[model samples]
Target: MTARNNSFDEQAVLHELKQFLPALSPGKTFTYRNPLEGFQEQTFDDALRHASEMLGYRTTLSLEEYRSLYNSKRVKPGVLEKVLVEKKGAANTFEWQDKVLMKKFPAAAESPSKIGKLRANWQKQYKTDLDARVHPRLFRILGNYLDHGVSDWKFPVRGKGFLDSMREVESNSFVSAFNTPRARNLLLQASSSINDLLTVIVGDEMLFKQYLFDQQFAHRGWSGLVATLEIGREISPNGSNITLRELIVFELLLEIDVLDDRLGRHWEPLSYRLPAPPEDLFAPVPVGEKSEVLAIWQEAVEWSYYEAILAELRQDPQNTRNQTGTRVTETTFANAVDSLCIIGQPSLLRSVTAEHRAFRHGYDFSLDPNGEMLEEILEAVVPSLGVANLECFFARTGLAGMDDILTDQMIGLLGLADTARGDLQAPLPAGLTKDFEPMRLLCVVEQFPETVLEVIDRLAVQSTCVGRRSVGRRSIALWLLNEWVHLVVIDPVSRELRVLKNRKMITYKSAPRIVIEDAVH
Candidate 1:
């Protein structure tokens, strides 16, 4: 695969690419274009399988992963059986499903040469597994890229172009590295010579397009960067274009250039073979420290939405507070960057983002009648915060000092300040216990006031009979305050609470002050 003259038909390559690549406009005119846009002719499952074969992507879950989902009931075995029966019409679809479940699927296979060598050298030099040794920030960014769920924001690339902004991250950007005379000569040669690699990887234009689609979904950040940089080759209307096949070759050339520096290998044959490099290049930085490079990458990638929020906050000068705090100043930007750097885990970041969004929801609702500010605030907060803390997350925007109100009002309304003290417990029905944790109760009260009163009413009656009921009985007292009333609940057995509800039907919904007295006393 020696370097060829820059005489290859660029149009031919571009023409081949047009059959498969999706036309992606810049982030400014972003739309919900399907990642699988080119494969509209095939079913999702068939497209997944074909793309997996072409790009070495994981098209389906592995047996162990599927088994975990099945056991968790996320993917019910019964449902799979029924679907299989309908689709295959086999005599015993259950038997066929069981066989499919027992089989092991291969994990995505690694490519040859440069990438493989780098991974090997990394393991050999550091005595650390490359996959296990990613920097926290790098891992966080990668998690967000690969996240098929739980992430509300997807593939946010900002700036004049992907490579344009990526250059600002450090003194030496990929653009500068590849734009050098020597790098330029190599790119020209490789650009002209890409058809050879494409011929080996993709027989027809459709397969090449499918490979692009697969690669984009496989690591959208990198693919998106390539797409934006090579917009010149696009065949779409108005000079706008996306051609993933050429982008793959272009990105590979960049990787080869970088690898030439990293390993001091000419790696000229890589231009010929064009083995897929790892989706991203890392310095193989030490495993413990936060990755400043990855942080920079993430910041550049998400700068648009970040600045958009700052701009919107500037419009409303009176409101300086957001869920993440002050939005009108430089500190807000710094805090956003710091959050991106420090959050070690993606799940934790997601949790923090969710909590921050929820806080902004309540806070914005309190501040303005219109929901536009809320939407903007949420969009800004989406990038920061760890999702790891979501399991027990609560909104902390304007709810300051409310915990004290909740506790004191229950005692004041019930007139059981001396009797209940700290011993009262909320007795949940056996059927509802799984859904009735304290944080869940708080979430219900906070978000859905109309939906939670019945449950609260049941809890109130049980609080009244706690000490007198039996030797081993206990109850949980809950206090809720909405716009209308300060409601207190004592949770006990449903039957016992039902008797109280029937006994005090008169004051139940209207006068919370009297309702507490009749139900509890």
Candidate 2:
């Protein structure tokens, strides 16, 4: 096509785009890409397709007219037959600085008045009439459908009359509660159901399954969620397994802004097994006699709730310890940075933020209610960091291979203790098999070079050996002078000790202080 003709064609299509795609306001986006053959009137058709979907459009163009337009070679695929709409939600960049998110309130203001006012307003305006909203009802009914089974939805704007309704709730009752504030809690239970259904759906049918599939440990998250939702049938309706329902519940717990759970949450009412409260040592373990407890807690759940016990174990005096932790394991936190090095989860640990970070004589770890609270600390700190910062963590913890500042005694003692820990719980497949393993072992010395000397200075302790002996492990002491880690390790079988890591090579000129020498074994 000549440049002049191309200009004319472009102008004509641009005109049509304005007429057809009138719904694409600034900041709203819709997508349409056509895969037609050669010489297709690419621009006009793409614009037409873009405009069609704005107002409940499902088809781009009718067959007869489209054939005539394409037969004469007025359009071509991969040329102009791609539709772009405005992306939605939020204002533009430069409006907020990159570091704007880093700036948090000086302290959390727990203003009751504002919260009370918002609650009152919510009950009056939204809570009262939420049950009647069409979108909200769709969200809820969908959940019920998942938990109960809904291969046949007639899309009847009414309830109870649908096949799903006749089998579960009374049609009349469903019609009455279809779009009301009363059904909101049911919606919340449905998220797990949807999560389960979607995984099954994608797993069974999708072509490019790996990309979209949730591969979080055989979809354990979905399984856990489904287990929770199945209990909802007696509490919700027969089947209200939907994603929106879970979002409502998550939002409520996280203190995030979301639709009211009763409004759009999907759920299955509980008839058989209602979920019990979290079980763990965090729960009051009445000592004298084993009282008939209401229920049991998973081992992970049990261990997770022991932050107070952990704090006490550390011999805290001030009691100013923050004891809450989250569901983060060691491997997940470490893997967030580089795949080249893999750190398996010896135990679930809480993540620490700058606010909660602390240091003692031999090691550093927050006063978590449970012994491991790394997941919690990381949640707050991970977002405000560089990709490289992912591996950076509190270095003073008893974990070995994380740093080199600790003396061979401190390092060895930790490994032996960890070795004994194998008696408590078996070490996992990817987990490290240390003669003494370090608990909540964190090392960021290499990543955060500025703290290397400071950490070494703190490690200069006289009685670190006592704690090491108590734990059945020892620490290795060395310096990362120049660019090498000059260190030592003790052989478990020999009984007599030897050089840990003699000078093998020195490469990086940027780090010049390190020197390597042959130390006799």
Candidate 3:
């Protein structure tokens, strides 16, 4: 091969190649390093795109994987909403929500690297498999050259760089890994510089750096090992000296030799077959709808966990400390008890008591106390009885002559009647019945003829008692007055009165009634 004027910066290409290689030093203790340490100065999204487009690496989980997390509730709705709001602004929350939850998008295809396309043509255009033929031998050779301590015998030329050592061994050995003599001759006679070999193989000086990147990254595991060992001597205890430049040069020589053996010595460089130079590997990756969708889901998944942590941190310090097992004081215990009473227990008890009362009242009034014969009589008389007839019946029954009383005051009398009746059966404690005046009045009212009157004059409208027969404590009477049917119930044991008008119960404290007169009107 003849030397040509350099059209590219060889040192710059080598320096950039070092940046893309694995930076982790191999030793007894494992250490971590960013694979894209080269793009450290770039934004996270930029670095991710570069790694993906140039190296064919996946930087984040798949969209479906994130969607599965959402289904499992590992990604919370509130957290996702907040994340969307932060990313897209509150105005677009609904827009983004629909996109993430309902919209469907196809997965983005992996972008092919620039140099990958160049090498792939050999298999597409011709039946030759360059990677299949070259990678195995190239990896084996690179692996032996950069062996840390795994080899039984160390490489012969320890400190002399990779190409020098490989050439020395190939020249001396009777058996060789190469298929052709041209391969051996190239290794022995070729300049150690990567640019010299690229001039022969690539021909296009502009594509030299990209070609090197493509070739090295095809076997990046071995390439990275060589690159790692080259930069960091302390990575291996034996201190192997190697450079990425030497690895690239030798790998190119192997490719050329393989092409000669497979196709012919006359085969041209990859540049001759190309329509145009390959795209820049480090160019900005284009953003599409798929990436946007993935980005939204990715942020949502991450924020799901972070939101929970932030919520806890934002809580009241005292409450947070208590939750973490702080001692409870008497005041705190009392406060908790008060809160339980106010929020949890009293309202529940009130609801249950009201329901029980309604049920009991409904059951007590479900049946007619007087029997089916009187039901037929009242049902027949109810339609014919007018307000004049009802007023006359009230007058004859003596209910119209009673003094006026407010509904609340009438209810108070019923309560007193209940107490007085209970006292008659079981003697009250001495002070509990200090005054029996209300009790005396209740007994007087119970003895009135109107309390048990059954028949009315002229109209023949007999008031019939109705109540639950199973519970014999209360007695009810049905009165037909014009269009209304009134049920007046008196507890037999307590003599307490309650009215159900038009089949609905009314609050005794609020509803006003003129006793028999209201029914007449």
Local distance difference test values of all predictions, in order: 0.30, 0.22, 0.46
TM-score of each: 0.30, 0.16, 0.56
168 Cα displacement, candidate 2 (Å) = 3.0
lDDT (tens digit, per residue) of candidate 2 on 433-504 = 221111122222111222223333333231132211221111111221111112111111221222211222
True lDDT of residue 518, candidate 1: 15
Residue 24, candidate 1: C-alpha displacement in angstroms:
7.9
TM-score quality measure for candidate 3: 0.56
Give candidate 2's whole-model lDDT: 0.22
TM-score quality measure for candidate 1? 0.30
Model 1 per-residue lDDT tens digits across residues 1-521: 33434444646645444333332232222222223333334433344334334333332333453344345433333334434554447686556454445544344335511122423433354343423322222323322333333334332433222222223332333434342354345544434455555343332332333333333333333334335335433222222233445445544444344444444543333234334433322122132111221121122222322323223222222222333554323211211211221111122122222212222223322333333342233222321122111111111101010111113223332233345443211111123222211111111011122223444444435422212222110112111211011121211111111101211211211101111111100
Best of the two (2, 3) by lDDT: 3
The deviation in Å at residue 198 for candidate 2 is 10
**Cα RMSD (Å) between model 1 and the true structure?**
24.9
